[model samples]
Structures are given as structure tokens and as C-alpha cells.
Target: MTAVIEVQNLTKRYKDKHALDNVSLSIEGNAIYGLLGRNGAGKTTLMSILTAQNFESAGTVKVFGEHPYENSHVLSRICFVRESQKYPDDATPRHAFKAASLFFKNWDQEFAEQLINDFQLPMKQTIKKLSRGQLSAVGVIIGLASRAEITFFDEPYLGLDAVARQIFYDRLLDDYAEFPRTIILSSHLIDEVSNLIEHVIVIDNGEILMNEDTDAVRDRAVTVVGDKAKVDAWVADREVLHREALGRVVSVTVLGALSDDERAEVTASGLDLAPVSLQQLIVRLTQKAGAETSSDNQEVR
Candidate 1:
């Protein structure tokens, strides 16, 4: 897989706060990537820099082996669907699609029309008068139908209901199958998009917390449920991410993969081992990172 986006020691500072802190990572082409983190975690900042919408305070960023700023060639191949995408006060969905068609060389007018119909969007209504869900539909339609070589969706479907969001996800996957491209999706609905993403990149406190294959991330933790005494003995030397207890029964989530023999032993000991979902794993990892950061700050003081 070729790298379509690259960053080296990237840093974006705003006054006294760092939006991005010495972040370094490469995004491969022709795959779906989840750019995930809590609010203020630099997900949007990183995407802004990559799409040339904002400047990085320090370090380097490259898209398609060249700087993205003022580079029409690089910019043309990228589509950025912001969460609060704006349009002219008088512009309607029709005008919005028209402008997008002219900008994105790979834009599919037929596909755009189909999406409009799917969402039942009113074409002539001014964008300002449109409902929140309708406004979001416009962005989703543009993002999907543009078909740019590399697309970034920064929570553009937040206003849509569950069913509508599902439609966007389905259409995205369908189009991507026929025309493969690099898609970086930054969203708070981690569990919703977990299966859709091929890779995961997690940021926390302006730093990269986790970057790896989604499958590998899933294997990073496991939960065991059994008697308190048995669970405590089994997890005594392991790193525990989360734990819960109810009347003598204990459930402990630990970091590390158990070998086949160990898994067998666990079952033989009457403990139930459960696989961790991507969302669960990411939440635990971020919480752990936050706890450690607080501890370190206290030590520094």
C-alpha cells in the first residue's frame, strides 16, 4: 500500500495550547481510516492541516508527495466535508451540488441526484431554512458523490438520525468498492463506524495514543468474568484496564493477548473470556492514557 499522506513531527499551537503535539504518522492510500478521539483531541486540527484549510505551527506535512498549501493539483484530488459546512445564504441544495460538480473532476452528477432522492432533500429551499438533518444530508451527498481521490469527513453526518447515517455509510462503502480511494473519517460514533474502518488512529491530549490495524487493536485487550478470588489471582500480574464486581463475581478487563494454552487453561478454570470490541478497546486505552497523564502532571508538580 502506498502512503498518500505523511506527517513528520507535526505541531500546531494556538497561543499557549498545542492543538497537535509533535505528531508523526503516515496514511496509506485506497483504504478507510478512522481518525478517532474525544473532542479537543486534535482530530479536527490534523485533518484541517492535511486538507490545507489551516497552517501547522511547526513540522512538515505532505499529500501525494508534495506540500498541499496553494497546490491546486493536490487540493483538487482531496475533498473535505466539515461538520459545520457552510454555503451562501441564498444557495440551496441544487446550487451546492452544482458547485461541487464543477470543483470535483470525478464528481458524478447521476450519483448526486440519486442521493438527493434517497434523502428526500428539497432542492430549491435556501440552505439556511433547511433543518439540521437536511443540512447534514447536503454535506453527505457532496462527500459521497464527489469521489475525490482522498476524502476527509469530519463528523459531517452528526445531524442525521440513525437510519439516515446508515444510508450514508452504505453508500460510501458501495461507491468505495467500485472506485477505491483513501477515506479518513473523524467521528464520535466509534462503535457505529468500527466495522467500516480498516485502520484506526487515536489521538489524545494532542498526541498519538494508538495507531495500528483494527484487528491488532482488537487483540490488545480481553475481559474475563468469574469468581473474585479466581479473577484476582489470574490478573494479579497483568495490566488491568477496567474491573467490575457484583456480589462475589468479578469481571476484569486486562491488557495482553492470551495464548491458546492460556485460553484453554482459563476455560478449564471456569472463567469466561470475552473478546473486546474496537470501541471498548479504544475507550479503555484513552481512559488509561488520561489517567497516566494526570499522574505524571501531579508528579511534576
Candidate 2:
């Protein structure tokens, strides 16, 4: 697969803070990628730079083999749907869709109309008067219907309810099957989008923590549940991410893949091995990273 977006030692600084710290990664074309991280972790910063909405303080960024800044050709092929996207005070959902149709050459008016009906959005009502969820629906509709070569959805559906969000996910997947394009989605609802994303990129404190296929990430950790003493001994030499104890029982999540023989040995030892979900693994990894950072700060003090 060819890389459509590439970064080399990219860094974005805000005053004394490093919004992005020497980050380097490549995004392949025609795949769904989850740009995931906690708040203030640089997910939005990276997306903004890629979409040419913000400038990088240092290093290089390329979208479709060219710098995105002031590059109309590259910019036109990309669509960015942000949660805080603003509109004209008098603009309505209908007006927004019409403008998007003209901007994105691949925009599908029929699909946009379908989404508007699915969300029960009022076409004539001014965007300023719409409810929070309705406003989000507007962005969701534009993002899905635009069908740009690369679409960045930065938590644009936060205001949507569960059912409405499900509709967005379903429609996105269905459309993607027919028209495959690169999608980079950033959201706090990791579990909800886990299945939809083909790859995962995790950032922490302006650094890239993990970037890999979703399946590979899932196997990066496993939980073992058994008697407290047995589980403790079993994981003593392993890198443990998290641990929980209840009476005589213990559950320890360790980072590493078990071999076939090791798996049998674990089962033979009467311990139950459980697969760690993507959300669980990411949470543990970020927590561990945060703790290490704190320790380093304390040492400097």
C-alpha cells in the first residue's frame, strides 16, 4: 500500500509547550484509521496540521506527496469535520449542504439528503437555532456525503445520541464499502469505533505511543485470572499493565503475546486467559506512560 500522508520528525510547539514532539508516521490510502488519544494528547493538533488548518512549528508534513499549506489541489481532496466547526449565523442545514456540495467534487447530494432524513434534520431551520445534537448531525452529514479522498472527523459526533451515532457509523461503513477512501477518525469513544477502524494510532503527551494494525494491537496484551498467589508468580517476570485482586482471586493484564506452548501451559496451570480489548489496552498503555512521565518529573525535582 502506498502512503498518502507522510510526516518526518514533525513538531508543533505552542509557546513553551510541545503540541507535537518529533512525531513521524505514514498514513496509507483507502483505509479507515483511528486517531486516538486522551484530551491534550495532540490528536487534534496532528489532524489540523494535516488538513492545513494549523502550521507545524518544525519538521515536514506531506499530503499526497506535497505540502498541504496553500495547496489547493491537496486541500480540495481532503475534508475536515471538526466538533467546533462554525457556520454563518443565518446559514441553515440546507445551506451548509449546498456549500459542501460545491466544495467537494465527489460530494453526493443524494447521500446527503438521505442522511438529513435519517437524522430528521430540519432543512430550513438556521444552524444557530438547532440543538447540539442537531448541529452535530449537520457535520456528520457533510463529512459522510462529501466523500473526499481523505476525510478527517475530529470528534464531530459527540453531541449525537447513541442511536443517531450508530446510524452515522452504519452509513459510513456502507458508503466506504462502495467508495473506499482514507478516513482518519479521532474520538473519545474508542470502543464504539474500535470495530470500524482498520488501524490505530495512539498519541500521548505529544508523542506517538503506538501505531499499528488494530488486530496486532489487540494481541499486545492479555489478562490472566487465577488464585492471587499463582497469578502473581506467573506474571512476576512479565511487564504488567494492570492488576486487580478480590479475596483470593487475582486478574493481571500483562503486555506480551503468549506462544502456543505457553498458552497450553497457562491453561494447564488452571489460570483463565482473557483477550484484552483495544480500549482496555490503550487505557493501560497511556496510564503507564503518564506514570512514567510523572516519575521522571519527580526525579528532576
Candidate 2's TM-score: 0.98
Model 1 CA lDDT for position 229: 99
Q: C-alpha displacement of 166 in model 2, angstroms?
A: 0.5
TM-score of 1: 0.98
lDDT of 1 by residue, 1-301 (tens): 8999999999999999999999999999999999999998999999999999999999999999999999999999999998688888999999999999999999999999999999989998999999999999999999999999999999989999999999999999999999999999998789999989999999998999989988888788999999999999999999999999999999999999899999999999999999988888888989999999999999999
Off by over 4 Å in 2: none
In candidate 1, position 92 carries an lDDT of 90
Off by over 4 Å in 1: none
